[model samples]
Target: MPNSSANQVSVIALTQIGAALARKIQGQLPISQLVLPEKYAVDGEQSFGRCQFKATCQMLFKTSDVVICIMATGIVVRTIAPIIKDKTVDPAVLVIDERANHVISLLSGHVGGANAWTNRIAKLVKADPVITTATDTEHVQALDTLAQRFDGWYPDFKYATKLINGRLAAGDRVNIYIDSDFRGIVTDLTGFTEINEVADDRFDVPLVIISDKTGYPKRQNSIQVIPRVNVLGVGCRKGIPYDAMQAAFVAFCQQHGLTWRSFYQVGSITKKQHENAIHYLAATLNIPVKFYSADNLQTVADHYSQSAFVKKTVGVGNVANTAAELASGSRTFTDRFATDEVTLAASRKKLKVDDS
Candidate 1:
């Protein structure tokens, strides 16, 4: 939310007092404003007109990352009930009292960040946060929060969450096994057991295995967290079809024992910045695409596998390796692989934990 524009919060007020309170809170955060009735509308404020609460909520739910409602709990719940879907995709929803005495996280507390937002608003407005999430109340870290912190992806989160949190609530230790060292993941958190090796007969304890390796052993009461460490540097022939390039890329990762979820980004030369196929692959993987100029790639050319044909055609001996090195700020972790029309290389970026 700080650097990326994808997720934005929307704050809505239903009365003049609520509108005034919303303005005070908005000054402390980045959010869009919506008010009900013409009288409640401050200058430059967007008004939903008379009696359009439900309609406004429907639209905001679809577009906003989080919806902060300054109104009664029952009114907010009834308005959003019909449109409620899966918690993973839904925006965080919070409700505040008109007098700003209590800030309640009404929905999507964990993954959608409603609980965190509630606490933030509460501190700003001098109110109490009514957070009911069991893990938060018990002072234990949530599995989803860990995954977000590491930029890891979880498969079958619902089952994983229920099993892990149930173990924590029952005073059982949950084992965490990470293949690579990641900073700021406090192993000392309550109810967590960091294991160095795979343990036998730990089915009673929930296990969290973090890695990018393929074909890892699966176990009951366990979950896999895929860290995004691999950066893909790609080069393709002009006018190549996206499907062809995508298939090659997938095959390369599969052959190398890498998961697509481990990819942090895709990089390429600036000439391919407008290439539809590269952009398509990036969007499909939900990863960012970074481009570097020929001069930039040339600086790292000595560290890459060079090709005479590529040098003659593109002014660089290697595109994939050079671009990957620039994107990752490190040398290639794996050798460059090539198809007839596309070249792929990979690098691993060091993970920096945010202490703040």
Candidate 2:
């Protein structure tokens, strides 16, 4: 296994047969932990007593990336119904019979990757994989899957996705617009027409637009996928407030015509490694951030605009632009914003679509 779930899994076994089956699965998937009642738990299993099963399941439902329950579909459904919020945020939920005859993708089929995990678990247990998602059943590449494949951010519009995917499954025309810079290598082109620009006259068909730019406004039946190709370099005064940093970044995005989802990573000099505000900002945006040593940032400092005060304080004249350039590993470019407490710069990772 490639550890897609960060090695966090919960296999709920309600009975002896389920426990045996869970053990079989756990043997192959070392990342998965067996969750069973205390009576059924043998050793090295998460044992819950009498009335604790439901609570345990609820807790694991929130924490685990995948929850595979060896129980009736109805039981799993009722147990998780209260906590199920949305497909985007929920964990992959799978249901299997005590005998492991069928592995069903019960919830979060596409975005949470339950469908894929269902197939994997079925293969491991030699069970039939039951996936009911239209895209999977109809043999059409899903819009969300397409976004995920290319590291693009799933658009916030779920209704648009439902309508577009419905049309795609029904063999209707769906236009896909890939911005020149945002179009990475897509392996499939079935059930879609590639268009340079969405025509103003076409309103009957659905449109799928992939880009980091904010040029395409949301239409009646359209989904916009933001490519996570932007790298952010940030610098801030000591103990800068999180709200101020966030406001500055939001302003930067507005000025650049980019969505917050366009950024995949954040970078700053190592001196600000303990900066709580920067870390909070990155966490709020659900983006990973890294810190580079001042020496590493210095190598690229001269390529960008410098500040004497910054050099005197941190031994580097330009933290934001230099950090962005270094993190992106590209030739110098110039896009920066300076605020009273924060300086921010953005660099786009070289687009594969731009390749000749």
Candidate 3:
């Protein structure tokens, strides 16, 4: 199975039959089964057997990516209400009947991925996925979900959900402006206008802008979806704190007017592969990390700002600039920016689409 730690799922069962069903589901999917002390059976690193359901659900709801409760929906709802805070940060909650006849997505249907999980489980168990979200029933896609699917990000999600999808749900026209030809990222273009540029006077209708430009199309009703086109090359001292690395990167982006969400991936030297801070930063940003050897970095060294000290210490003339070019497989988009310990640079990756 894939890394269970990365995509953690907690399954809680109240009855023996439910526990049996939970085990079956866990065997099929990459998940950790949580059962009472008396019903503990599965033994492995993946099993979290012998735990209180209410407490486990409360804890996992905050920590796990998704939570599956195989019991009465009412009981799961009442247990989690006290701890629930924001739908954006909350884990997807799914409630399935003990008999495995039905699967209902209870909370965070879109942003939290509950709706998708419900459909997957329903298919496996031959049960109906009861999705209560209006957008799913109305055949209107959620903007946040679309952003995730395209490896993009949007700010003010609540406002976008309320304004953009709301207008579409009411049968209103919505305009989408992309600086480049990226229509292939979107599957449905039924009620959207694909334009090369958005006019300043086009603020009356809902708009979705996908671009990497510093600043363009300043409007209130427009939701900017930043495409993952830039590669972030990073070089940091060993044992650096994750927060420091993240803060330095954020500051660099702000100074350059770059959107951190537009970063396609993070690149570093292969020696730093075991560095916890690097992995932590990549995981927190939801971006993959690419490692390059000293030899690989040397191939792009001539195109970057070379440093004798970096060459002497790390066997490379430059770390950030070379890694950025190597990661993007293109020229540098901006000059290298450095902090006391961390260095960051960026390169643009061109987007291509078929005309036909």
Best by TM-score: 1
CA displacement after TM-score superposition, residue 53 of candidate 2 (Å): 2.4
Which residue ranges in model 3 land beyond 4 Å of their true spot?
A: 1-7, 34-37, 40-51, 189-191, 234-261, 264-314, 325-345, 348-356
**Candidate lDDT (C-alpha), each:** 0.83, 0.83, 0.78
TM-score list, all predictions: 0.83, 0.76, 0.72
lDDT of model 3 at position 155? 84
Model 1 residue 246 lDDT score: 90
TM-score of 1: 0.83
Cα lDDT for residue 90, candidate 2: 96
Residues 260-352, model 1: lDDT tens digits? 889989999998898999999999999999999888899999986688988888889999999998998889888889898899999888766
Select the stronger candidate by lDDT from 1 and 3: 1
How would you encode candidate 2's per-residue C-alpha lDDT over 238-306 as one tens digit per residue?
999989998998888888888888888899999999999999988988989999988999988878879
Any idea how many clashes model 3 has? 0
